[model samples]
Target: MDMQMARIGLFFDGQAELQRWSHQENIFERFIIEVLEHARVPYQMIDDISKFNTVDLLIVGLASENHLIKEALLEYAASGGIVISYGGLELLSQELGCKILPPLEAGYLVLPAEFGQEDPLRYLKANPWQYIDSESVKQTGELSGDDQKSAALLQIPVGKGYVDRWAINIPETIVGLQQGTSPVTEDGIPAPDGTANLDEGILKADDGFELDWEKDRKTTETGMPYFFTPYADLWREVLLGHLTRRALDKGLTLPVLEYWPAGVQHMAMISFDSDMNINEAAEATLQVLKQEDVQTTWCIIAPGFSKEIYEKAKVDGHELALHYNALEAEDGVWSEEAFLEQLEWLKGAADETNFTSNKNHYTRFEGWGELFQWCEKNGIQADQTRGPSKKGNVGFLFGTCQPYFPISLADEQNRFYDVMEIGFLTQDMNHPSLADTTIIQPFLEKAKRVDGVAHFLFHQHHIYHLPKVKEALIEVVRKARAAGFTFWTSKQINDWERARRTLTVSANGRLEVLGAAELPDVKVWIPLADADAEERGLTYKYGLPGKTQVLQVQLNKVEL
Candidate 1:
């Protein structure tokens, strides 16, 4: 019953197109890397076949069409290693026991709920894939469509392992969507009235790109104008399924509880945006926090008369973050002089020389890259302005529940923003249609289910003036505590993410920390799945001030 860690290997052929694309924009590999890190899965980018011997799972991209690589992958699968192929790598279709049919020239691919209810892919049923072809194989999963049912995803069991083949070019599809490339019909023209018919219960955008409206509504609605799906969620689901299956097959447990510090299942950050009545609102919020013994962030508008309240909150161990309002600009475009003036005013008003976090007023910014540059230059370590509210909705705008650095799609070099973006998943004003606070529970549930950060933004004025608002805030704290969520400020969340960036775990049970930041006490949890595998050094806890830390845990060896 010994357990073996899963070693994931990604094969890259160094193709010129891939290299160019990597240089220009975010690619599938980047997403894969992020998902793997979040899941604490050890992986390596493999360009040479020599490394195949150490890999338990092999991931091949479309660019990997070399004959030698194909032979290596087939052998690996034959020897009981999982192999997941994306786009290309067509040479092994027959060997993998699946047939790669002609390219499916459809506008979009729909993933019905019936097929993925128990799978991790259930989170992606709301979103549809744009521009997908068809694959012919024994459908191991459910397939739903109007015309002849086709396999969008195929799982074929080969010797002792399996092969997962995706019909869509996922990386290219992501790039096209990011670049605003429109989805077109099979005739190479935009679909009439910006939509095309796939089958029953399927509607796709005429343009090759996903339309915002499609995601705002349900696919089964009248006319089925929209195909609601979360793009990032879909990718994560694909990875999670493969990783989980491999772990189970290897007599190991998937690390499902390692997202937050101290092995906490989830995290919550509460911030009160002081838009009006700063003095009274601040006092009320402070009293509430003191009563609950919780520390939260207070974002006050610059040049406002809230200096005394800000100082009081700081004295109470609450975070005083800048709420940039005076320098609001259109299209995220800002004037340097005006921006600097706002920053200076906030510093003087709060009587603080430096600030670590910010959230723009109304969450408005000219451009993410420009805002990030300004924040970095101004010594702002974190920004929580990026959320799903841009379209005036309450959901993950970036399709991510965790904090991450924003990448500029417009920048030809595809540079990473120097600042951390703690995306706001929910705010008080997000759902104007709701009369009460029922929306909070659903958002919290989603965050906890994914072991993601639940960053909530509430207005101080609302708590003071609106009864329902105060009730909602109370309910949030109660439910979050009941669910074992660690409440953190923006600064704390930023610091944790920064530390995790340099943390690494190897398949051999080596935990390495290369970051220099001072981190809070955290516990790493590794579940014991096998009866014969006794938990040996499965959990480790570390406290502050360590520049670098490494721990070695003894894991039982398992035979494949």
Candidate 2:
């Protein structure tokens, strides 16, 4: 079976129950579906377990009280099929060779499963899980618990197959996050003063900012969507590990770590928001870029800045993109008409006809989906504004450091917004709370450890006004270079990500390119572990305008 189209079934209780449970929005199902879709794993909801034989894997919700469904699942597992159960493990505990124990009073928290280095869920930790008791099963891996003694997740081997029992309520966590409430918060009340230590400094979000608790909460209590923010790569790893294991069990090969370019580990993109002191700041920032031989994206507010400075930055190999001024908008709400008016005015003032990148001032927007749609409709190809604006606080607003097309929360399946979103890791203005300039190094290291993009933003005014800010920016660039990060402007990163989304890999080491005919020439990198085609002298440089390109390799000899 093609992993890209791997057939998986999601068994739910019913449409009405799902709607009522998810608050009539399908948020829970959508969250799971989004994860599956991102992994290129095709899935569909099934009302009957009789169709289990047709799928490679079965993910069933625990809320189903039907005995027929329970019996069907047992039969499927016994017949050598993989089953992952969420919520309702009591119905299958006996079949799984375990006894259900009394639930914990304080519930459970998600932690790394003790499966050593081979565990797929090893990297993901600290999410909330529902409490449950279970007798230890043979060959089981403990994945979650409140303390080291409890078990929230258990992998039970039955016959030729296995069942992953997720006792925690993942859907509830997702639903609570979508509602802008933390699942683990005590009665939904935030800490006194709404300030909490994140990384090294106290992040203050209590001053009536929307999503304030989200920024203040340092741990998984921030809830899903955002809770998954720093761990999107880990989520992908868990999903890919499951799929890869199933494929290997069937004597097949699968590509690994193909999302990043050439598997260089982590990447960094430097950008400067042109706030004030346009001429002096731009000149100073340009000097630093030239000295470091680094190219970056410059977001310019075009009302009063000199066209000569913009042209000079463009000539110096820096990207000049639009910075939508939120203060200019009426009541900080951006309509398509008002947005376009400012975009055109800015473009004309800067003497640029086309712009492919943008970052909104103050990171303000009416709706994330709306902003993405407007950018797509207006010809902006990429954006980097979907993060918190305050300093001393750094976390994923979208739960990913990888570039992805923003999904519409209102219309879950609408895919028309083709613009790419490159997440912001940190900004220079927010670094003062740390002990020294070196605190930013860990942020970059975390991104690298997960093979993510560590895009950093600095205001030109800050660079000119604060000596320590300039020193910090310089240190960041130097450290990123030493860490083997290939620095790219926002436009370059966006273009590369667009090309990557079109790539397809097979278990047998066949590489194919699709839907990239209109894109520019791009250098595709397959990691050495998956570099069987390159070992056989396959072409790595691809010039597009072709719908498909195929390369074959020997998968059996490829090492993990």
Candidate 3:
């Protein structure tokens, strides 16, 4: 907190046409007020332009026709003050100068958007018109209807100050206030109505927009608004940063985590199969991901994937995997007959490189090394080839859903290779009964409690046909982020190893890791190389996995 916090004057001419665009909850005003508070940027609502002299930030809420207020805001900008105007700010942006040219149209944020003019009630929550590349919008990640768009230019630097114009009001500040986050998110629910399906949009030409509420899935419950207060820790830290920057001496000591030597304490891996559409999946799949988004490594890819498909995807910042389904031949790559045959086939399939890591199709046999003894030796860092999961939940005992390597040598019983095993947390997500929101929540809770990483195994076919699942996966990442899950790609891991410190501490010393590696003290529970599972099989018959690690850390823990 600064003694000289920002004195933001929010100009609200009672007749501003912006008022006519009142959000479901008067979100614009709520957002304006909240940003000032959360950012610890103190502000006031002004009804008259005369209230300008003492303010550091002037927010003018203009009616599309409020020419007087618009000009005044320009004057404020020229006078070297922050001038942010919404609602009719388009005219000012073009005549006054800004970056985001007004959009040709706009629409309200809806939960499950309406689709099919024929069957109006087909509640699909997205529109086909949102230009994937909207030059003006700044915030990234997921976009929803509530996030207003401006038909006007979104830019800064009016005269001496900066100007921001919006066609629709975005109450991110208010939503953050209620949800305790500056970003739009519904953390826990995988598909909990307005939460999981979060988005925000703005007003545009109006001609290109269409929203038939009677057919749409709907917005949040009137009382339980889609947006709520965000967390306080972020605001506190930011407030302190600004206060310190202003040279405002407040003796405000804030807790901070600095210079993370080993980042990403946790990570996730996705499994692919022969069905991956390398050529066409980029735009539909990889491109749809949030920008600078969380990264993931693909496993079990065919050798054919590397040449053109993988290269193209790599260009778009996507990772590749061996996608080894050598098990397609019932005998698996281990048997002398299977291994020799599979190895020869794979080696000649393509020249880029052998599969980095291979997975048993259906997990019938995950020992991919049979085909190529150089799993870790080659470059394969992780293996996600476990359960697509049968009726009950499943996982490697002693192994957490989070990434961890088998620290022991592979033996006859449980001879898992030397890479990290990302056990299954959820699968068949597109399957009917599995899509229930109720089911996903408890699963997530159990994951948090039992070191589950919300392991999701998505196939391209699943994403192509079931867009909702694609949406769910997004929610999964969001929830994972909220629950302190740090995303890590092998590259990030390499980054850590590259900068790692050679500890000179005593042999018994240890350190904790968080995010990618939990901190305070990082203690990874390495599974025993082998667990004599013949004498220790799961109760009943591969019974339901409880809050316990399903497989012992040892190789023998996995009953062959």
Listed in order, each prediction's TM-score against the native is 0.71, 0.70, 0.37
Q: Report the Cα RMSD per candidate.
A: 9.0, 8.5, 25.6
Displacement of residue 164 (Cα, Å) in model 2 is 2.0
TM-score of 2: 0.70
Candidate 2 per-residue C-alpha lDDT over 527-556 given as tens digits, one digit per residue, 9 for 90 to 100: 221334324544221110112222332223
lDDT of 2: 0.56
In terms of lDDT, which candidate is strongest? 1
- Score residue 515 of candidate 3 by CA lDDT: 30
Clash count, one per candidate? 19, 8, 69
Candidate achieving higher TM-score, 1 or 2: 1
lDDT of 1 at 127: 14
Q: Per the 3 Å backbone cut-off, how many clashing residue pairs does candidate 1 have? A: 19
Q: Model 1: runs farther than 4 Å from truth?
A: 17-19, 22-26, 61-80, 87-138, 143-148, 156-162, 168-238, 250-257, 263-265, 326-341, 365-368, 376-378, 388-392, 408-418, 429-435, 506-560
In candidate 1, what are the lDDT values of residues 1-560, reduced to their tens digit? 23355677877666633565666643433445545655556678887777776877777753445677778777777788877765555677656554444454324454545223222222211111212323433343333331444455566666776666665555444433322232222222233344432222211122123334433433221232222334444455555654665565676544432556654557998987777745787788778788787788877674465667877788888888877763323222245555566778788888889888888776544432566778888899998875533222345434556666644452434445678777675566323332234545656776775567777778877777776677777778888888788889998888777666555443334433223444444444444333233434443211001112233322232111
Q: What's the alpha carbon RMSD for model 2? A: 8.5
**Sort by TM-score, top down from the best:** 1, 2, 3
- Minimum summed lDDT over a 10-residue window in model 1 is located at 540-549
Q: Point out where model 2 deviates above 4 Å.
A: 1-23, 31-51, 60-75, 85-150, 156-160, 168-229, 246-252, 263-265, 302-304, 328-332, 365-368, 395-399, 410-417, 429-436, 509-560
In order of lDDT, best first, we have 1, 2, 3
